[model samples]
Target chain A: MPKVTYRQHDGSEETLEVRAGTSLMLGALTGGVEGIEAECGGSCMCATCHVYVDEAWLDKLPKVQVLEDEMLDDTASERKPNSRLSCQIEMSDALDGIVVELPESQI
Target chain B: MATDEAAGLVVIGGSHAGHQVAIAARAAGFEGPVTVLSDERELPYQRPPLSKAYLMGKQPREALLFRPAAFYEEQGIDLRLGVSATAIDRAAHTVTCDNGTVLSYRKLVIATGTRVRPLTVPGSDLVGVHYIRTLADIDAMLAELDRVKSVVVIGGGFIGLEGAAALKTMGRDVAVVELADRLMTRGVGKTVSTFYADHHRSQGVDVRLSTGVERLEGENGQVTGVILSGGETLPADMVIVGIGVLPNQEIAEEAGVDCANGIIVDENTQTSDPDILAVGDCAQFEGRFYDGSLRLESVQNATDQARTAGATVSGEKKPYDSAPWFWSDQFDLKLQMTGITVGYDTEVIRGDVAAGEFSVFYFKGDTWLGTDTVNQPANHIASRRLLDAGYALSQAEAADEGLALKELVKAARKGG
Candidate 1:
């Protein structure tokens, strides 16, 4: 199991131990974390699950796909270099302690 | 500054799009009260999973809701479940509910969505014949799952293929009967259609192409088989119809809204009347994705239009100019498509189609039209950006397999 931490914009954080092979969005959603809308239900069609990956873990995660990047442009918040759609990031044993910060709103 | 009155913004139909309209109105600083009317008993839920996870019993009922009932209350939205807007009083700016409640609204959003197009044939109303639309329909079908050994799915559209895949996964014998020559004929090109048909057939689904279901054959008020146009009987204890859907536009039409195939709306999702707006599947508007007017039945269109409509009602006018995108999952293949492919002059295939990771890019003369990618999310995303930015790719450049599509999109953006 990979333990991921989801930090909110209001300086609150919640960590969960999610099974490998599931997505970060699924982990946050299954764990009842606020701010990740995920309206498309992990289909990569909606950009509601926008998050800012911790700078240290940015290069450690998989490369951002073009699809996820396009969706990031449509995020409610301004897109940053570290902004990623959490739904596109699949959890694995190697990435056990990754941290993601949620945006203010995922409209 | 003048204070805005506490007027009501009533949204008809509490599906995914309807819920968004209500939520967006509040999010966009609409000081008016928001009311959402739904005919279904449950709160706003994701309907896409109904044919797949929910039907397979893998997804629980609670997992279907887009947001909890508490979320609506927290947002100060008046969520009315199990009640429908029967009539729209355009002149009075009020809506009459089926429960005899008349609510006046300052702005009305019609997001009635669509209903499954019924199969009107002999024995169509037999007990085991089912249509997958709402959660109730899926639950009813699940109740008869154990008794059904074989299922004959009518249509080769997305819902039909998805339902067939789910049934096959559940160890049931399934067959997809399509009237068109290929699967997803109207949506995708011939290459994609054939690829999907072959893929579904490889997954143990009997893909019957160019076959019309003349009528259903039932015994003792229970469906037993489906009769083909050539009089061949396919033994099926269960029947799932995914032919298509018709927009629920009757209520809007009665209110004297301009409706052709669907309620015609402008770029802001505003209908013939400025106070009246339409979103989701029932709303037809001129979009940049296609040449003229188009009504998309996907969640992307629903969400996008809802945001625009909500913003417009709240005094922020944003045009619905975004390129349309859609995705469908069947068996193990995840297809992501963007833009419209109806009038492509040339087709370019990139990646290995046999390996199940390929994208077909369509172009008209020198302009990029759209793309359909199977298990190629990167290509789908890049194509959408290019289309949205009005970046055209020449036939020569799009056909080159060595050039990365993302890089091309980046270059197009820089050059444009």
Candidate 2:
């Protein structure tokens, strides 16, 4: 199990051991974590499961493709450099221990 | 003002909502540096037909592009593609970008839209599983439609049911497993859902209600079937999950704005902060439609609310008032809806439900809340005007098989 940490705006962090190959979204949902709503599952159709990767982990994840980029622009929260739709990010062994910032808002 | 002046307008997000906001801004004579930041690399496209028309090949992908690529250039919009807003420093009035670029703005419009829900159960990671929320999703499904012999749709809501119907029309075996008791329970009333379930069944769809999919069963890195909660097995070569959507308002929350089911806004779509506004599926506006509540997911809602937010940002305070409307088409059947019918006590009909052509009106205390017109465009159109006007109807007039809807609305307007 890979440990995933979510940092909310209040400077508190919730860490969960996400099963391998689980989309970071399901990991959060299954861990009973708050903030990330994997609405629409991870279809890139809805941007509800939005999160911001710590700048350090941005390079570790898969590159944001055209479709994912397209949907991110539509997010209601203020778009940012670290912003990512958590549904598109899958948990892998390489990300054994990673930290992501919870979106301050999830519409 | 020319491009040199930088229209002083910042629109972050470019789809149905953002584009409309930009166009409305230009229409309102704000001639400064009108910048539109679009994260979608494929230009501005609408997602309305991703499940039906586009899947059926009745509409081209380019047709779905909200506006021509040239329209942005001609309008002198600094429409940046493949770029996203990284952060909003409201105190500094700047929008930071991923590429180390920061845009200074006098005002900003955040029309970030919604996404399709992803399937979360085990084996959802398998290949050939898709969501009908974007053009890419449709492209993959349409390409696989020819090869896939069967499909398992996880939800029987409008998107799931419509996509299942379309796939089934292509001669594929489709199993629509819905957690809800009926189809489109949120959009239309229960009676109308029954009519659609029967309609879908008569058309050869396996309509499974009150059934929940526990997991996707896969083999060889591909979807094989879905396991039901009751230990039933559904064979399938592919799966399309259309559970629903949630608003993308993460950035707003971090900035300390109020959000409930969605970002909380007033009738004008203004959030807790006066500087920021919310719209589209990501927004929860305190609105009333018919005798029930309101918060729609159709493109109509996106554009309507976008227009209101755009105008307001431009210093025009207009109360947002647009009759909620939506449409979903399947196999020669067009299901159009007007207003929302959440808590209607009486549902009246004016056509034949069995014949696959009829209109069901939900009314509470003699006032219409909403109408679902299946294959009856005229009735749907009239229902929109009547419902928007808060027109009244008697029990006899509402269900009169011989009554003309146009005449009915006129009569209701006369205080009859």
Candidate 3:
């Protein structure tokens, strides 16, 4: 299992051990990290799983696609250069010890 | 509640609302622990199927479940199914479960949603009297369908009517009884409802309107017949009730949140307590801003409200302003509706109702209020767009059945 560290807005951290071949959204889910809702399951119909890939590990994940890009643009959170839908990011050994930041709002 | 980094989030339900809240919390950049408490053992699921696709047995369990196991694991969500929140402590911000475990949270989302309103008349607890709400209900209904050749549905609402239609298509002697004056009286206009009722009766369903059921009569603890309010008795081996639902807002009310018919929230889905939010059929918001001060019941409302709620959890204060929409599938017919049709003074029936491809367009004065389309997805799609875009329709163009909606609206515009 790879360890994923989630950095909170107020300078705190909650780490979860995630198995490879899972999504960052799932890692956050089973690990009990806060603030990822994934409303439409993983259908990409809803953008509740929005997250920001840590600046350092941004290149390690797959590129965001057109649908995800479209959804991210609709997210209430301001899209940053590092914004990504966590559901689409499959965890892997290459992404071990990665970090993702949460936006101030999701509505 | 203080913004303590150690305070975890605990969502007490596991379907549309619960799943969305967890994901949206993470999306909004919250940094703490998150846990989903669910009673059902199955993974979180899309529930629209329980009445349609799942009832027909065409959709598998995987098709209805939310996401795969790995999605939860990788998202770092602690999904504790087979668990339920038994009580709440507002001061401590903790939820006590039946298993004697207590989970603490900085903020809480009460997404308990709703349970199907049960039939409350005499013999309601009989073996053959059923209410179609959950997967278990459908499974029980499907099993009984094979042993019986006739069914008398006790309600004429959407679920009761759809169940009657589905069983009728299966070649059973199906009968529908409604206390209302027409089928889907709460949904469509009188004209459209009449047309649909005529169609159902023509298809061999005993469509009984203005009828109220008194009790389910039985022999040896099983259903045998129904006694109506008019003192008329009808024979049947099975009965399905679709009386509608009540919002599951007791928990929110007890937790000190403002709860009316549902958990009262604003357009942003924010409850009065600030620390709690409600969504789905369990939520009630501002009144008469669109319709006659009403709350809605549908899948579109659930998913859309979930999005708005999720966004709120993400820390944004966006109001839920998306136009409401809903769909229902019947035997060889698809009914799509948009907006609130309560205040329409004039309705123009486009195309031929006899041919079954027309739409009922409702307008209040000059503005388009809403529309109901039967078997015309394209027309419904166009109507939803035009209604949502705030386009007005002239009485002449709206009354003219020969003119296409596009051309009619274009010609009736201010400049034209």
Candidate 4:
């Protein structure tokens, strides 16, 4: 199992051991880590699962797709340079201990 | 309030809305025993993919679940799958289940959703005829797919077209029979409908419009072909019907809940009986976006309404005001719509429609109605935000493909 830390907008953090194959959005949802609404259920159709990856792990994460880049423009919160749709990020051993910060809102 | 201690929150239906109600209630700090009763044996799953990804075998059954099975236990939600609420006793604040179990609730949320309207034509009950409404329906259809060489899909709604597309992708001969003059007349505009019909035809699907299935021809109780109104017989190894759906509001209606086409709910999602609330496809809510009460059958409606109902149950009364949105994945095209496109007198097309990447911005005079975007996600999201903010783009601006919709949304927000 690989662990992922979810940092809330209020500066609180919660870490959970997510299954290797699950996406970060599902991991946060199953672990009850707040702030990831995942309205589209990992389809990348809704940008509600937007999260800012930790700067340290930004280079290691998978590159954003064109659709994701387009959807990032519509996030309810400001889209930082490291902003990515959590549903698009699949958890793996290489990406273990990755930290992602939640936005203020995901409407 | 004697029963309040033992009676927590009871939710009926395990679809999107019902599942969301439980999760949202817990998230809203409702510290009582939350129980969800679902007629389905499997955990609550996504219905949208049933005719697309799931039908194409791209997504497995596990992937269809809204949440992992263990998540319910962790949330203290007693998810009762394979059980259904047979009746609701409003006087006693109790629900009687088909399994002969009785459950009491402080607040009851009815998310019974809707069922497929059965095709009453002859041979409709043949073995090869199917309806795509549940996981079981898709699974059964999948089991027969290997043997099916040709399929005739009745109705031109989202389900029928998506199914036809999936079947065609699977190398099966598919024909879509629509009684209406255009495809998806109930949801999308004529332009969108025409585009889809043409697209399906280009993809080798026999798109039949203004054609009616007078009767089904069957061999040994299995559907073999469809007899058209003009006395033409189209051979089919299987038949899929997706005409429409009817809300499952029998229990609510029996309990004297105000009912029309669906269970009536206010902005707070509270039904006629204050103790009971209804959401999703089974709920007809007083319109905030359109005039008169409206019933929407989409994941967005279910999820948003459930959230509002959860808040109301937790004593946080937030009105249901989210703009309704829907999406469909057919072949390689992703169609996303925001707001209601009804009563639109004018439509603005952005991008290249010939290249299959464009959006139709519908407007009734100066009022913005909604937009239907194809292969354009940014426009879809921006349209939703614009509608939610009660802002409309000028006709000229919407027609200008050079202008990005996101920038316009930002400009609108800043202008306010």
Worst 10 residues of 4 chain A by lDDT: A29-38
Model 3, docking class: incorrect
lDDT by residue for model 2 over B132-207, one digit each (tens)? 8778778877777778998999988889888988888878998899998888878888767898888788889999
- CA lDDT, every prediction? 0.87, 0.77, 0.75, 0.90
lDDT of 3 by residue, B1-416 (tens): 33323567777788777876787677667567878888878788777667666777655555466666777777678888889888777888787877888777777777788888888888888888888776668878888878888789988888887788778877889899989898887788877889889888889999889989888899999989989999998898988888888988877777787777888888777788776777777888764327534567776577666667666766776567666666666677767777788767888788789997778888778766778888765556556545545666566666676666655334444444
Arrange candidates by lDDT, highest first: which order? 4, 1, 2, 3
Q: How do all the candidates rank in terms of TM-score, highest first?
A: 4, 1, 3, 2
Deviation in Å, model 3, residue A69 alpha carbon: 23
Least accurate stretch of 10 residues (summed lDDT) in model 1 chain B?
Answer: B1-10
Query: What TM-score, computed on C-alpha atoms, does each candidate reach?
Result: 0.90, 0.75, 0.76, 0.93
DockQ class, candidate 1 = acceptable
Best by TM-score: 4
What's each prediction's clash count? 0, 38, 40, 0
Best by lDDT: 4
Q: What is the TM-score of chain A alone in each candidate?
A: 0.96, 0.95, 0.93, 0.98
Ranking by DockQ: 4, 1, 3, 2
Winner by DockQ: 4
lDDT of 1 by residue, B109-146 (tens): 99999999999989899999999999999989989999
**What stretches of model 3 exceed 4 Å from their correct place?**
A1-107, B1-6, B287-289, B400-416
Model 4 stretches astray by more than 4 angstroms: A1-22, A27-35, A60-62, A91-105, B1-5
